[model samples]
Target: MAKSKPVLNVALVGYAFMGRAHSNAYRQVNRYFTDCPYEIVPKVLVGRSAGPLAEAAGQLGWQESSTDFAATIRRSDIHLVDISTPNDSHFPLTMQALDAGKIVLTEKPLAMTSAEARQMAAKAAALKRPSLIWHNYRRCPAAMTAAALIADGKLGTIQQVRAVYLQDWLTDDACPWLWRMDAGVCGSGAHGDLNAHLIDMTRFLTGLEFSEVVALQETFIKQRRKPDGSGLGTVNVDDAFLFLARLSNGATASYEATRVAAGRKNYNRIEINGTRGSLVWNFERMNELEYFSFDDEPRVQGFRTIMCMNGGAHPYAGSYWPDGHIIGYEHTFVNSLYDFLVCLKNGTDYRPNFSDGVANQEVLDAALLSAQRKAWVTVEQSQHFAGRAEPTRVAAKNAGL
Candidate 1:
C-alpha cells in the first residue's frame, strides 16, 4: 500500500471575481492533479456579509463560511490563508495571518506601495514562512515555455520587449464606479491592477529589473454613478497608462495597460526581440507561442506558431489531456495552486515570492512618481533596500543623470 500524503486546509477571504477563480482552482486542482504531494481542502470561505456566505460556500465547495475575517484567521485548524481582498486590506490581513504562523498567499500588486510591500516582505522573512503573490500569468504553459527558452539562450542577447494588457469592460461612460476606481482601495487604477502582471511577467521572462521609467496616465471617464446608486462620485483612478522603461539588462521596453481600450478584451500580448531570435505570446490564444529563429534555414524562415499542448514539453498540460487539446485561463490558477502545494510538500520556497512582489511594487511606485514629476524616475527610489538582491548599477547611473 502507498503512504497517504498530508492534507492542507485553506481559508479564503473574499468571494468576488478573484475569489471565484481561486475557489475553482482549490476545488479542481486535487481532482486533476492527483500527483501533487498534498491534498488541498477548502476549509472555510470568509466574506463581509452573512446573507451570501452560505450560497457562496455551497457553490465554491467550502466546508464552512464566516462573516468575520479576523475570526477566520485566528482558527488554529487553518493551515493556509488566501487573501483576494482589495489593496487597502492586504497589508493588515496578511500581517495578521503571518503572525498566526499560517502560509499566506495574496493576489497581485502586493500592497498599496513599495513601503508596505517591503514591510510585509521583512515580516515574512523574519518569520521564515512561505509567502506567495498570485502572479498567476507566469503559470501559463506558453509563458513558462517562453521563460525556459529565454533562459536556455534561445532568444540570445535580448534587445527590446513590448507588452500590453487591454480590456473593454469599463469603456462605457455610464459604467458604475466600484472599489477598483477608488485609489484608496486599488492604489493606481490600471497601472497597478493590470500593468502589475505585465511588469512581473517582464521580470520573470527576462530575469531583469526595471531601472527607470517615464510615464503618462489618463482618466477618460472622470465620474460615474456609484455602485450603491446613491450619487455621483469622482473617478480618481486612471483608465489608461503608458510607460517607457529600461531594464537592468540594458534592454528598452514599452508597456501599456488600460481598462478602456475599445474592442480589446483581455488582449494581453508580449513580444520580445533578441539578437538570435524573437518570440511572441498572447493571452487571447493562450496555448500558442510564435517563434522566429535566425538559425532557421533561409528557405523556411518565418514565424511558427508552436502549439504548447504537448504534455512532455509543457509545464502543466500532461495532467489534463493529450497533445493538441489546449487548456484555458482558469487552468493557470490551478497550475499556480499545484505549484504552491508542491513547494509545501518539498519544503521549498515559492517563486515570485514576496521579494519579487516588492521588486514589482518598486516599479509601479516609480511609474506613478514619473507621471507626477513629468520626468524620468529611477525605479529604485531607495537603493539601500532595492539594491540588496539585484545590483544597482543601472539605477545608480539613472540617479546620477
Candidate 2:
C-alpha cells in the first residue's frame, strides 16, 4: 500500500467579499474533486481585529483565526497563504510569504504599481516558489472553452479581440464610499477593479500580449460623501476607461470598463474574431459559448450558442455536476484552487503567476500613461520609463510576433 500524502494547510488573510469567496472554494474543491492529490483545509483566518476575524472564521468554517499576519506566515505548519487583502498589502504579504518559503495565492491587480509587481515577480522567480495570481474569471466554463477552441486551431490566426466589463454598483450617489473609491487603498478605480480581468481574459483566450494603447479615462462622480456621512471625498481615480490596443500578434483589441453604467450589473463580455471563426462569452450567460464558423455555407453564417454542461466532456467539469447541470461564480475560485494544489503536488509552476501579474500591471500603467499623454503608448516604453524590467523573453516569444 502507498503512503497517503498530507493535506495542504491554508491560512487566508482578509475576511470580506473575496475572503468569503475564496474560503468557499477551499471547502468545495476537495468535496467535489476527490482525486485531487492534496487536500486543502482552512487552517487559519488573518485580519486586522481579532473579534471580526474570529467571527468571520467561524462563519466561513475556518478552524482558527489570528490578527497578526506575520505570525501566521511564520508558522512552520501552514503550507499556503491565500491573500485576499486590499491592493496596497498584496506586495508586502506576498514578499514576506515567499521569504518564509510558503506558497502564495493573491487576488488580482497583483500590486499597486507595475514596479512593485515586478519586484514581487523577480523575488518569486529567484526563490522558485509556487505563486498564483487569482484571476478567477479565466476559470469560467465559457472562457475555458474559448481557450480550448482557439488552442485547437478551430479559430485560426486570431484577428481581433474586444472586451467590456461594466457594473452599476457605483452609479448612484448613495453607494457608500468604500475602499474601492479610495485610490490609496484600491489603486486605480474601475481600471484595476474591472479592466484587469478583461486584460487577462484576452491574453488567456487569444494568447496575445498588448503592445500599445490609445486610451481615455473619466471620473463622472468626482465627489461623494464618506460612508460615515461626516464629509465628502474627492474621487481621484477614473470611474470609467476606454482604449484601443494592438496585440503582439498584429491583432487589434478594444477594451472598456465602467462602474457607472446604469443598467449593466456585473456584465463582463468578450468577443474574439479569427481567420477561420469567432467566439464570444458573457459572464451573465456563463454556461454558454458562442461560435461562428466561416466554413459553413455563406448564407448560413451566424453565431451559434453551445451549452457548456459540466461533466467528463469538459475540462474540470467532471469534478462537480453531471452533464447539462450548471455551476456558478464561486466555482471558478474552487477550480483555481484545485489547479494550485495540482501544481504543488507536481512541483510545477501555476498559471497566471506573479510575472503575469506584472504584465497585467504593465498594461494598466500604459493605459494610464496613454490617458495622461493623450496619445498612443507602447507597453515596453511605459515599463522602461517606469524603471521596471521588460517582460521575460519567454513571454515575448510566446506572444507570437
Candidate 3:
C-alpha cells in the first residue's frame, strides 16, 4: 500500500463573517473535490477576544484557538496561514507569515494602501512561496466560465465592461456605524469593501489593466449612533462610489458601488461586451449567465440567459451538484481553498496572487485620487506608500493632451 499524502494543516485568523466562510470551505472542499491532492485540516483559530474565539473554534471545528497571531503563524505544525482579520492587520500578519517561509492565504484589499500592497507582493515574489489573495468572487463557476469564453476568443475583441456591486446594509440612518465606516479600519469604505470585487472581476473577465479612472465618491449619512449607543460617530469614508475607467485592452469600464442602494440586497452585477459577443452575471441570481453572440440569427440576437449547472460541462461544478442546482456565496471560498490546496500540492502559482492584490489596490488608490482631484487619474502614476516614487501618468492618446 502507498503511504498517504500528508494533510495540510491550516490556521485561520479571525472568526467573523469571512472567517466562518473560509472555515466552512476548509471543512467542505476535500469532501467534495476529491481530486484535491492534499488533505486540509483545520489546525488553529486566532482572534483577539477569548470567548467568541473559543466559540468560533468549536463551531468551525478547529483543533484549538489562540489570541496571539504571531504564535499562530510561527507554529511549525501549521502549513498555511489564512488571514481573515480586519483590513488593517492583513499586511502585518501576511508579511510575518511570508518571512517565516510559510504559505499564506489572505482576505481581499490586501492592504490599506496600494504601496503597502505592492511591498507585500514584492516580498512574496522574492520569497517564491505560495501566497494567495482571497478574491473569491473570481472562483464563481459562472464567472470562471465567462472568463474562459473571453480567453478563448469567444467574445472577440472586448469593447466595454460595466460592473456594479450594491448592498442595502447601510441604507438606514439608524444603522449603527461600525468599523466599516472608519477610514482607519476599512480603508475607503464601499470602494475597498465592495468595489474591489468588481474591479478584480473587471480585470479577470476582460484581461485588462486600468489605465485611468475618473470617480465621484459620496458619504450619504455623515453621522450615525455607535453600535453601543455611545452618542454619534462621524462617518469618515464614502458610503458610495462611482467611476469610469480606461483599460489597457482599449476597453471602457463603468463601475459603481453603494452600501445604501435602497432596493438592492447584495446585488453584484457585471456585463462585458465584445465585437463578437457579450456576457453578464448577477450575484443575486448566481446560477445564471446571460450571454449574447452576434453569430446567432439576427432576428433572435438578443441576450440569452444560460443556466449555469456544474454537473458536466463546468469546471468544479461536476464534483458537488447536478444541473441547475445552485451554490451560494460560501462555496466560492471552498473553491478558492481547493485551488490553493491543489497549487500547494503541485507547486503551481495560484490565481489572484499578491501581485494581483497590489494591482487591484492601485486601481482603488487611483479611484480615490480621481475623486479627490475631480479629474481623470492614471493608476500607474499614483503614489502608494511613503517614500515611493510617483507612478507615471500618461494621458490617453484619444484625450489629445
Candidate 4:
C-alpha cells in the first residue's frame, strides 16, 4: 500500500477572474506535481451569492460552496485561505485568516494601501505563519532562467532596466466602469493592476531594491456606465502610469503601465542591460528569452533567442511537455503553487511572501505620492525580506544556461 499524502483543505474567497485562475491552479497542481507533499483539496468555494458560487464550484472542481465567509474561514478543517477578492478586502480577510491560524494566499497588490499591507505583514510575522501573495509571473520558466543568469553574475553589474505593461481593453470609451476604476477599491488602475507585476519581476530578476521614484499618471476616461446600470460612474484611478527610478545598487530603471495604449494587449515586456550582457522577456512570447553576452566572440556577438521549453535544462519546464514544446500562462500559476507547497514541505521561506508584498506596495505608494507631489518620492522599503531560498535561483542552477 502506498503512503497517504497529508491533505490541505482550501477555502477560496471571490469567484471572479483571479478566482478562476487560482481555482484552476489548485485543481491541477497535484496532478502534475505528484511528489507534492499534500493532497490539495479545493474544499470550499466561498462568495457573496449562493447560486453563482455553487455553479462555479462544480465547474471549477471544488467540493462545496458557501456564502458565509466569516464562519467558513474559521472552520477548523480549513487549512488554507485564498483571497481572490478585490484589492480593498485583502487586509481584512488576511488578518481574519491569520487569526484562525490558517495559511493565507492573496492576489497581487496585496492591499488597497501600503498601511494595510504593513499590518497584514506584521500580523503574519507575529503569528509566525507563512503568508503568500500571488506574483505568478516570476514562475515563468524564461523569467526564472533570467533570474538565475543574473544571480550567477552573467548580467555583471546591472545598470538599467526598462519594463512596460500595456493593454487596450479600456481604450474604448464604451467600456463600462468596474471596481478597478475606483481608487477606493483597487488602489490604482494600470499602476496597481499591471506595474505591480513589473515591479515584482524586476526585483526578482536583479534582487535590487528601489531607492526612489518620480511618476506621471493620467485618467483618460473620467467616467463610464456602472455595472448596476444606474448611471455614469466616476473613474478615479489612473488609465496610464509611468515612472523613473533608481535602484539600491545605483541601477536606473523605467516602468510604464497603461490600458489605453492602442494596438497593445497584455504586452508585459521587460529588458535588463548590464555590464557583461543583456536580457529581455516578453509575456507575448513567454517561452523565449533574448540574451546577449559580451563574452561571445566579436563575430558571434548578436543576441540569441533561447527556447525555454527544454525540459531538461529549463526551470519548471521538465514538469510538462517535451523540449521545444511550449506551455501557456496557466502553467505559471501552477508552478508558483507547487513552489509554495514545496516551501511548506521543506520548512523553507517563499518569495512574494507578506513582507515582500509589503515592499511592492511601498513602491506603489511612493509612485502615487510622487505623481501627487510632482517630485521624486523615496521608497520606504525596509520591509523587503529576502527569503533563505528562492525557486528561480534554484531553477537557474539546474538550467545552467
Q: What TM-score do all the candidates reach, one by one?
A: 0.94, 0.94, 0.94, 0.94
In order, candidate lDDTs are: 0.87, 0.86, 0.85, 0.88
RMSD versus native structure for model 4: 8.1
Candidate with best lDDT: 4
| Stretches of candidate 2 exceeding 4 Å from the true structure | 1-3, 384-401
Model 4 misses residue 362 by how many Å? 0.5
Task: Give me the runs in candidate 3 sitting further than 4 Å from their true place.
Answer: 1-3, 384-401
Candidate 2, residue 7: the lDDT equals 83
C-alpha RMSD by candidate, in order:
7.1, 6.4, 7.2, 8.1
State in Å the error of residue 43, model 1.
0.5
Tell me the deviation in Å of residue 56 in model 2.
Answer: 0.6
What is the alpha-carbon lDDT for the whole of candidate 2? 0.86
User: Against the hidden true structure, what lDDT does model 4 obtain?
Assistant: 0.88
What tens-digit string does per-residue lDDT give for candidate 1 at 1-401? 86787888999988888999999999899888989888789999987677797899998899999876667778889999998878767777788789888999998889877888999999999998888999999999999999999999998999999999999888997889987887766778899988999999999998988999999999999998998989987778789999999999899999999999999999999999999999998999989999999999999999999999898889888989999898988899999989988887788988888989999999998888887778899987623222112212221132111
Q: Is candidate 3 or candidate 4 better by lDDT?
A: 4
Candidate numbers, best lDDT first, in rank order? 4, 1, 2, 3
Tens-digit per-residue lDDT, 9-34, candidate 2: 99998889999999999899878878
